[model samples]
Target chain A: MNSSANSTMPIANRTVFFVSDGTGITAETFGHSVLTQFDMKFKQVRLPFIDTLDKAHEAVRKINEAFEKEGARPIVFSTLVKTDLAKVIFASKGMHMDLIQTFVSPLEQELGVKSTHTIGRSHNVADTEEYKNRIEAINFSLAHDDGQSDKNLSTADVILVGVSRSGKTPTSLYLAMQYGIKAANYPLIPEDFERGKLPSCLPAYKHKLFGLSILPERLSEIRNERRPGSKYASLENCRYEVNEAEALMRKEGIRWLSSTAKSIEEISTTILQEIKADVRIY
Target chain B: MNSSANSTMPIANRTVFFVSDGTGITAETFGHSVLTQFDMKFKQVRLPFIDTLDKAHEAVRKINEAFEKEGARPIVFSTLVKTDLAKVIFASKGMHMDLIQTFVSPLEQELGVKSTHTIGRSHNVADTEEYKNRIEAINFSLAHDDGQSDKNLSTADVILVGVSRSGKTPTSLYLAMQYGIKAANYPLIPEDFERGKLPSCLPAYKHKLFGLSILPERLSEIRNERRPGSKYASLENCRYEVNEAEALMRKEGIRWLSSTAKSIEEISTTILQEIKADVRIY
Candidate 1:
């Protein structure tokens, strides 16, 4: 199930640690993907903000403890930047996966220069102009969420249209949070469907429109969780809304996909491809 | 500038590509982290959703084009699961950095099992219970946002309190999106200061409370951008709000941090550490 630390298992097949000078999010994210390849669950621990020599040594202690308890070398995925910190962690009693250091030497040789080896450089905040732009994008997306404002519709990178609970809000927030793209979402409610047209305000920004449709069964389950035993959560009404929404999207020539089975990442990536949104790599 | 593809560089010192059979986000994220170790900025391109042979070959062609144009071997970071597709891309005229495959074999040896090697297994979406929990957490955070409701206040994993523009909203959203933490945020306005205490509703949830403070100068600048020339945007008002908010937090023994110089990731990670939120590894 990929649930964290199954207690009943007592001893996990392997122990894993995501160590980083910053948040262990990146280390855990990539390491989790690598581990997903193997159909085995790891007893995972996240040791973040290990920016100091003492903290690095402390991390080594934790890693060694896990290795001894598990009776095998733990898997350590680290993004620690300081060479001294890296050396300390690499010497731990675990199969250390240094995400950053492995490539730094090769990259240094290729670029003919010394590596910065700067910890926490990857997530510098609003101090950088680019980071500030990301903040603005988040604000824009929030202000314009749920068709809240049309004054700045012209500025949006992509405007998502979908039936209620058809996975619009989370997707829009992800675009803003993850990619710094201004995303505004609108729910294709019964009113829009009865009009036999796309939302009147959306026509002017037709090219930027992306639609997310969902299977009736999944839509019903998701909605029923929010408002149970209501007509809005009924399969019949969900079917109607989905059909009409798809019809409107098809007629209006807006690119669309059924998001019933897609993750937010997959949906966002597809939208970026279709809208040709400028990829802003942080 | 870290901007993509500086044309004025004529031929960039190096060209880099993040190629993946999925969104390429994972590839780009780690690749970017590794690249940040070097001081030089390279021309960058992302080739995502390269699942088919045609798309895989297309990626190779693009990588070759960048190599030819840059007059240097490009660096390719890939997470493609299919061996045939990876073979095609790796054989291109660039230095290949397969993020997934590099560690896959080692992980296999450690786990003593053959990898499923499933493409897109990392983000299986709402089909999985964990992913559904993420969606529920996002919806929960959105509903409980800005202290909108106290009905579910006890259910919240963390309740963030701060003055306006202290970055509570985006931080909450990031926690929900990235880590599935049920975060609720509240803004400590002049009214709360006038009352000379924490919000009445927050006392019971003191154990779950986290506060964010900001530099008055930065707060004033951020608020001014939203509400130009208003008293709320004035530095004096911002100073009063921040001082009062921090005082309230200190009096309540609520753990807090200044968000003025932190990214949303940094802020969220700090909150997680303080709140002891159960780590959900997806």
Candidate 2:
């Protein structure tokens, strides 16, 4: 924790570019992960869809301009697939980390094979079946959101049960979007608490159920923002509902996690891990 | 494209670990991106919340077991912040790539400073304000989905106007989740097409509006899956709706993109870039 002593040093501003042939999500995400380990602040720009030579040359110009303006070499993290485009960006006066080039050769040696070297396959609808599944999963998650449908619980890969506003909807959506999992979330309302069990439609599909719990104070705070000064937003009511929901889930042998301290990514990952769901898309 | 010749090679199956002290999202995403460059298949496992020495030791054991079982060293991509925990994982019998250690010192030297070396900062709810905004954005997007409400279009950061299933809902959710942008999606239905305009409430917020279009065949196919043999799912109807919608949007000076071939990530990124929206989350 004493690392804060370094704060006395002046912060340096650096220009960084995430250039890619497709959406640039992989480049930006991987580059940002590397950048987070550094203390220096970055003014980052994304240049996606640089699939053509003209676009690649334009990106090189932009990087060189940044280097000239800053009097320091910029850092370029690129995942361009074409050799010509990659060479164009690498020629810029910057520290270019060609992600695909860095690992593809080693992989070829290990696997005794060559890569496709095609652009946009990582984030494109190149596989028709996978694309259809992703869209179907998204539609399924949306249809099943918030106990809106009881017709397809049996078909869901996982069902997220939780109190209202306990991070169920976003987590379900994220699971669908990233992993192509058919995730359905049902809110635990007062009626479920009064019944001392889950909704009637959920028991048959209990194995697919995962529970989410949030801290009472946090739940109260979140609910207050939506409906201030309402009884539903009361701390006492939140505590009661959460306590009852947890007990019900525990009694039914359902696994649960606290959503208060976690992000949507964390919550969804935990659920996927616990359920041993097949990750259709990485 | 000739890379398919590599398919003749025997695929190597290796165990891969994406270990992190926080959500492991960065580790997984970055690792997956790297792994995609190779033709080898991987059995990937995620070990999140390895913030403690005990958890790190357990991770080491699991990694060693995978190595023993596979008769080859596993590949570990770790983003651990604590030095002690990172050292333990690095000592394992795998090709450990210490993501944080590999870059932190270089950054420290370049900036004439030190990093915070903080745990969980990358994917944690450490910033209460940011977390609150993300949740608020999710709520806003959900409430405004599918022309559900016109209550606060003026406050929205982006309003996506598109025909049904033109990749509106998922893109709106993604913008909300990843960037904390209040994205509202209004589906342009037959009524709007008949009227030759957008929704009545959208004109005042023209600057906030973005449009999505899709290939009529693709739209017809997607609709057919939902409502088979109906007018809404007819190719002629789809073509009419898409053509008219695009014409109306063009007349109104609304920028639009075809969603048929683009991934949700690409569509959302394009919109964000066009609007110059500040990406709040990395």
Candidate 3:
């Protein structure tokens, strides 16, 4: 239950940020950044959609319920939501939890503009004329690279191979977009796990082989989010699986990178560097 | 090419950032974040390898060259590669740039604890046991959703259909990771243009379709990055292609999203909310 935070306090005292516009990640990104910068200990909950006025009011009720259940105070960080809805939700629930609406006040002050009822984070870039195509290219490359059932691995400028749950995809996409490398990634799935060997497609390109290993407990927690009660998410199995995977990687002499806690930017760049691949120019 | 910063500046005056330690992305992440936050533009370059002492020395020489050429005072935010090599490099260079070594400074100042000489940014989240695995799952899902070959459109929780260079991949990854939704993307390649219809795979899943359109000049610039001198990357071609693609999408009654200046997070979430698909729990 994330006992890392004090659970006994009232909702108002403890900051509980339930960040979301109509979309969750946008709100979460800003909320996480601000939270990290301030070193504030807060419980973060993402409730993605609250687009309508009714849904916004409903969210307040849900927040109050969660606070009452936890016996703690809460603070909220909401982003890019409609002002009216945000006002209603914050006003109705402010007595219980302090709500920080991230985008509105500053945005309004800066541009003398309230959003034209738009629903997401504003794109602040140097070149709007060029950003669109870059975004589209990113989309094209992403759609083209799904590692499952794709046989054209040869076309990839770089290929990432890791056991299931190792950091490969984000690394690949980041490389593709940031540096314009045609990166492809394939998972070392359960079948490979059963064989106790790297997948067949890997060894031929072992020179480019990179592995991502993580600690078992972290794996368990992340897996728990996906499948809460299954043996697949069990800590014991995770430990065994991780140990076995690392051993196989070492025996195969496939150079590996540990992804435990490393962000996408770190993992991707590290893999590219270890492989000594050409510097991607975008 | 980027002749902005100069050398002969004091240690603190020069802002230098080295993006290496094998993972250029990690280095870039730290550099970009710090640089952006400070709004201090300086001479910046990425030296991707400093794994050995010799390589470290070579890196110093390259830095000297950049300093000499730019003539603008420099500052550095370097990723001091491996443990042994970092010590050697630091001793040789004697702390030149603004020199914010992410790993070293934090350990020394924050905990009054010194590191036992480790390489890379794994320490940022090094203690997380399952860090590698969670990253792997994200990468795997990212690979699977690439718009090109994941032809089983039926399984897509959301499918982004757009002209070439539309913001599809980032949007897909954002949806999958932030929302846990399996988003698939399909590009409107040139063949689709010649055929005068949407790709056959798209019509079957039209109900889940969302389109992304970009400003033509932005398309031109992105294409120029890929094929610098080609007519395909020409402004005229971009204009023609964009107009034709939009017409096709409009004719088909597919609700399209304009990706002119939207960040990937914004684009992805906006589409997810617009489609009202079931948000994935992760």
Candidate 4:
């Protein structure tokens, strides 16, 4: 009665690294970055809390058994080695297992920091009220905002207006998730330009506004890729659009950030700081 | 009566950069990375696909006008300077503007790679069908997957089961987003252990089933943080759950991953790869 007998079991051959105090997001983020560097197969699991000391011992025992049964050393990534938990895992340290601990001992020595408490790095970011708010805001915005055309969004916590592909989606997502703010974004479409004005939905929340603009040449090149041989993808149209967009942004008095040379994280975080909004989640 | 009228133009106090050959994501990525290094205020815009000559001219004209209106030297991040657009922007280059072009002249000089034809970096990644499919799959999964608890998921493309807080939500989201798969996850509740059995719902999709295990000590410590002084968060209970869960995973032949040290990205990608599912978007 193998649990994987009926399902696709596509994850059978891959190794996964899951590190968490209990909630797995923090460890997962770091794990993902490391995983991206490799072209190998793997999977992830984040077990946030075991709920007991005996549970720690049980986990160690299972690790040893799984290793013996599989006949291969699975890669184990772990963090938050509390003394009681560490003792259990230490017993199974080298019995047919390859372990990669992300809360590296080397990192501790390099950073000149040590904690008597071993609650893993995942808990570090969560310990901040400010950080919590921002992440929550980011989630909130994602949940609340709709990326639909013709949706009325007059009541947004922050309204991001930018030309197409100006890092609005990620920025807004980040804001909503990190800050728990209800963020909405509107692309200043070509139609808006033809009419010589900002989209009507924008002015209703004009005061809580920001813009993202990129260099026109950059815009033209991006559009060219999508519609290779059309006037819409023409450099002239790009220039016209960029120019008009800037003029409109200025005319509408919407302050903007140039996506030209900024990362989504930076753009989102900076806007959050400037607006001085309440960014703490819980 | 412009909406921005009440606000002091933040443009003067901020720097803005725009980089493109068109469809601005690539330039924007680099732009974001570089700008992240600086502690400054900036805005962004992205215009993609600027192949025609006239558009380039107009972009520069508008940029020049923006400089005057803002009364500041704008920092322009750009790429693919066709002669016509270059001429227009060049007017602002020395006086009221500073431009950083991503399509480096030095790159051509150093690598001996010359292109009369304009191109972008994103095109390289987008050109491959496999890569495109993967991206598409990931996008599709993201749209469809909501990362909620599923009660009737016996027909899941994949099912992740683990103790509470075992990197389930993010991993599920990653699978859905990156592979366009319908993944569902169910928690191993305490009641299952009290009865010494796997959840009833799991056996049906047993083939596609998976387990996520973590060091019990890590798990215990994690749980302790949330509910201190309870036996549920005690070492003994943790040991019981760990041992029982492992036995359950082993007895049922549900492959389990130790999410002790890995990031979520690593875990998810690894799982995806192990399952031999290509990344895709719907």
lDDT per residue, candidate 4, A35-61, as tens digits? Answer: 322223243333445435776666666
Please write out the lDDT profile of model 3 over residues B111-207, one tens digit for every residue.
2334334344332332333334334434544544435465455766777877666667676765654444667777886788889998876788888
Against the reference, the lDDT scores of all candidates come to 0.80, 0.79, 0.55, 0.52
lDDT of 1 at A134: 69
Error of 3 at A12 (Å): 14
Every model's TM-score = 0.95, 0.90, 0.48, 0.42
Q: Which ten residues in a row have the lowest lDDT in candidate 1 chain B?
A: B1-10
For model 2, how does the per-residue alpha-carbon lDDT over B1-282 read when each residue is reduced to its tens digit? 001112343445568888999778767766766666655556678888898888899999999998899888887877878888988999999887655676656656655666777786666652356566776788899899999999988889999998898989989987887767899999888898788878899999999999999999999998998899999999999999999899999999999998988877778889989888623222
DockQ of each: 0.48, 0.36, 0.09, 0.03
Candidate 1, A1-282: lDDT as tens digits = 122222232344577888999877778777877877765556677888999999999989988997888788988888888889999999999997878877778777776778766777666544766567667877888788788888789999899999988888999988887777889998788898889887789999998888999999999998898899999999999999999999989899988999988888889888877877633333
- Worst lDDT run of 10 residues, candidate 4 chain B, spans B1-10
Supply fnat for every model shown.
0.44, 0.28, 0.09, 0.00
TM-score of 4: 0.42
Lowest lDDT 10-residue stretch of candidate 2 chain B: B1-10
Which portions of model 3 show Cα errors greater than 4 Å?
A1-27, A30-74, A78-92, A95-123, A126-170, A174-282, B1-38, B41-147, B190-196, B229-231, B277-282
Tens digits of per-residue lDDT for model 3 on A1-282?
A: 001112242222343444444445433433332232222244455566577777777877777776687565344555534568767667644322211233234423432334344453223342433344444435444544446544655655666676556656566666665554667677766677789887777667666566778888878886787689778788987887788888888889877777776666556656656665433221
Q: How accurate locally is residue A43 in candidate 4, as Cα lDDT from 0 to 100? A: 38
How much is the TM-score of the A chain of model 1?
0.93
Model 2 TM-score on a 0 to 1 scale: 0.90
Off by over 4 Å in 4: A1-18, A28-78, A90-154, A216-235, A260-263, A278-282, B1-138, B141-282
- Best-matching candidate per TM-score: 1
Model 1: how far residue B125 lies from native, Å: 3.3
Native-referenced TM-scores of chain A, all candidate models: 0.93, 0.93, 0.50, 0.59
